[model samples]
Target: MLIRDLPYADPGVPDVRSGRHFLLWLGRRQLRGQAKSLAWGTLHMASVASIPIAVGLAVQAVVDRSGGGLALAGALLALLGLGATVGDTMLHRTAVTNWITAAARVQQLLARRTAELGATLTQRVAAGEVVAVSTGDIEKIGWCVESVSRFSAALVVALSVCVGLVVYEPELGLLVAAGLLLLIAVVLPLLPRATRRADLQREKAGRATELAADTVAGLRVLRGIGGEELFLRRYRSASQEVRQAAVRTARMWALIEAVQVALPGLLLIAVVWHGTGLAMDGRITVGELTTVYGAVTFLLFPLRLVQEFAMAYSFSRPSAARAARVLGLRRSGDGAGVGDGAGGGEARSLENPAEGDLHDPAGGLLAPAGRLTAVVCGDPDEAGRLAARLGGHDPSAEEDPAEEEGERPDARERALPSVLLGGVPLDAVPLEKARAAVLVQDKDPVLLSGTLRELLDVPGSGRVSANEALAAAQCADVLDALAQGTPGLNGDPLEARITERGRSLSGGQRQRLALARSLVTDPPVLVLDEPTSAVDSHTEARIAGALRRVRAGRTTVVLASSPLLLDCADQVVLLQDGRVTAAGTHRGLLRDDPHYRAVVTRETDDELAEGTTHA
Candidate 1:
């Protein structure tokens, strides 16, 4: 089949379709690059069938004592031998190519899908499942495809041999045909159970893989909390469960294999016994009897093919199902989507979309440029939740009052996100325009492994050098912690590679590094969750000044409890529950707002300890 036909051949087209059919659909997709290989593979099986036919003719000629017939038979035998060598070599080469290409395509599809999903994919699927699909599932899917071509060609050769045996001696031919049919059709009914068992085993293995990944990621936390042994025991139990499932699957497969090998041998014996009786009765010539024997001997190869197809499918069905399940994860907008704010609701200025002031109907508040704003909250979770909402991750509870209450709710309709740039509703503008105007740096910002220069080279960061961003985040001390340009050191710290999660750096170092990267962006609107939680008060104070200098003329929001950070803000808003309770300068709240002081100061710690003691 051609490559274009592959995508249209949906294995998921019908519920009634078997695993083998799904496998065939997958095979059709892979056959595009390996068409020539498949053609050569077919020729090899056809060439093998020629040997049995040539032997049968040669036998009849020798029995008749014909000299010319003997010469022709020898020539045919030589031709058969030549075909065998060529076919085998070409078959091996093609099969290997198909295997590698199928694997590569699956890998490419997964990577493309991941890129398309971006940050949203991580929120929905586990990291370990993605890891498992790329590494293990891809190989299994490839094996299933490559085996189809090999088995198809062999099956044709087997049928051709059976027809030849029937032509040479009709009565013995009938016996061979019936036996072969039984071998293929009757034995296959047992496979569904085998496949089901294999599916269970693979699922258990995937769970084990996920657990192992979790343990590795939380290894430090587990140890610090004295729960390492607890987690280790849990992982050990999970591993044992996987092992038990695998063993059960193995037992079922082994039983099927035993039947596969034994049944074919039994059929051969029965055919031989019946054919000999025919020869004695003069219903078949002695040479004809010999031809039937040769045919069955050759048919052994295809007989094995039929059995292996069943076995290969038993192993591959689970893997295919898993891949399908992963691909089936719906995109965010595919359901009742939070309005992407791309094209709906009221149109407004794209450059400085207003943040409709905390769901206040008195129009959105424009963030004044080059100023620091403090946001206080009673519920830390609620505050964090609002931050995520503001960042345009998912829908926030804050809704727009401009839209009529009776407007039809479309699952795809996302309320325009209420973020403002210089008093403009960020969602009122196009997403691309909004992103350019406002940037929210979340708590625990991820630091990808890269050089310091690479990290600071964000778009719109201006011509400000890496050193400047580092200076802004007060990261000079952090840079010193690294062994930069030291002789006998394996690498420069400025160029030193961090691990995937930046595990090599201290918490403060990572936080500062993340902060510096954000500073390098220099977007008009900067919202930082907590920039100096890791550093001591002295370092925090220095960072506050550095931040003020770097962010002058930029609208920056610092959602922090540190007085040092709040002391630098131009204004502070105290939010109780979900609504704004008070708005004033940092010092104004320290004196006039007892609730603010109780929530923000060290007395908050004493109160928490007292509450814990009472509990």
Candidate 2:
């Protein structure tokens, strides 16, 4: 089976298997590429094998020291030189191809998996592990692919040289073979220890990456709270731990390297000593002994290849296991069976969280056409979770049925409750389909680096003009800001260069820009998670009114506690604790619900305090 298929296979059994399984996983992936390169590798090996035979013949000729022998030796040496040069060149080229292709495939698989998991991936796996899998682990896997054929070809060539020597002079041949075996036995024991050290080193490095990532993400907050020094100290400590683990790892590898050099040199010494004694004993001719010596010397190179293969495998094992773990992750809510349904029309009637009807978790509504809806949640995390669910950024319905049935909906799901679209469950629909039908503009949406026009190009099935979308989003000011760009025909207002995540823009400008981008998609269902949270009250009020007007007939869910946004909603849903506490118009909620007043009025109080502080 394919390596890609192996990851999806039932790892039904425990992972007590030796590290060989990891190699098998990588080998399965490398099989096709290796097969393509194997022919060139075989030819290269043939050329390499010829070198030792030619050298032995030349040595025999030199010992004979006749005119004809000298002439033949010259030809042999010339042929050996040509073979070595050609073989080395071909070997390098083929090996590099094998490396690049294997790495590309792994990268593609990883990218595909990330797209499949979407936002839910971070919840399932640590960010550092993912980084390790994509970068360092991928390079190691590539090295394994590039090294495989060379190792095999070298082994065969080395064995061939040994056999030729045995035929030329058995006594010396036997002595050299013994030395080679001793080298193998000594180095083989180091593999396990070296691999364990490598694994620990990689794990510590991953933790350090995680700590650094956390620090970078919260740098603003850390600086704000005067905890920058504390986080810096923590990061330094993490880095030190990684440094110590690396040093230990290097020590083990250094021992292996010492053996690689020393054992081979010792073997070469023993072979020469034993061969000289045979020559002196008259049991072997000087010419024959010389041939034996040349063969043993040539054979040492391939022996080193074997040692390298062992080292490479030892280093790559941990990376492969980490990659395996990442691929093994399955979403918690993926459904067991395939969902067969065409999308359109009113969304399934979901549990109205604001209507005091805690709708069944199993049920969902296909969203209706053109209506403003409000989602209320006390906890921000709960609101975000609900937003993710509604956007279909979760998992597929085709995942294992038993896995889906085994787990119950947690409090987070019940508390934040998804707003569905159509008969098809939003959570079960694939990301591509779900995203087209519904878009969730997160509280802090990332505005990638690009010109304003380029950034406004949202992925969608329908044609929506950028200007109309921006106008609908009440972003005329953003267009004016971008007017600083060179004028274009038809008067394009989207030429403004947005810095990474739009950091160049103020908080309000960024929010309006993000909202404008979301509006461009014009998805049938738009879920805005506190879109106006960062804007001033006046801009927030204007945006709220514009959004309702622009999305007049479209299904829209706004998750907010803002009085302005709530007042503009056609219907309001208030969630308390984890259930729907009340549902009605914004004014009705203000009159009937104390919790609604407390939240919205408290926000107003905070605004007044901010004004006082400024004064």
Which one is best on lDDT?
A: 2
Residue-wise C-alpha lDDT for candidate 2, range 1-615, written one tens digit per residue: 233443433322212133346456556756766665565565666665665555656666777777687777678767766766776786787688767766666676677667766665665567777887899888987787688888888877778777876776777777777877887788778878887887788778878887887677567668779999998898899889889988987898788778877877787787778777877887776666666666666676676677677767767777766665555443333432223333223222322111122121432322345778887787887677666666665422222322321232342342323334544444554445555666778777778888887887767534457777677667777667666543562565566677676655667788888898887787777789889888888878888888887776677889998888999988888776546677888899777666676666665666656744654
Report the C-alpha lDDT of model 1 over 346-415, residue by residue, as the tens digit: 3333333332232322212223556778787766665655454444334332223222112323322544
Global lDDT of each candidate:
0.66, 0.67
Error of 2 at 580 (Å): 4.2
- True lDDT of residue 3, candidate 1: 34
In angstroms, what RMSD does candidate 1 have relative to the true structure?
Answer: 7.6
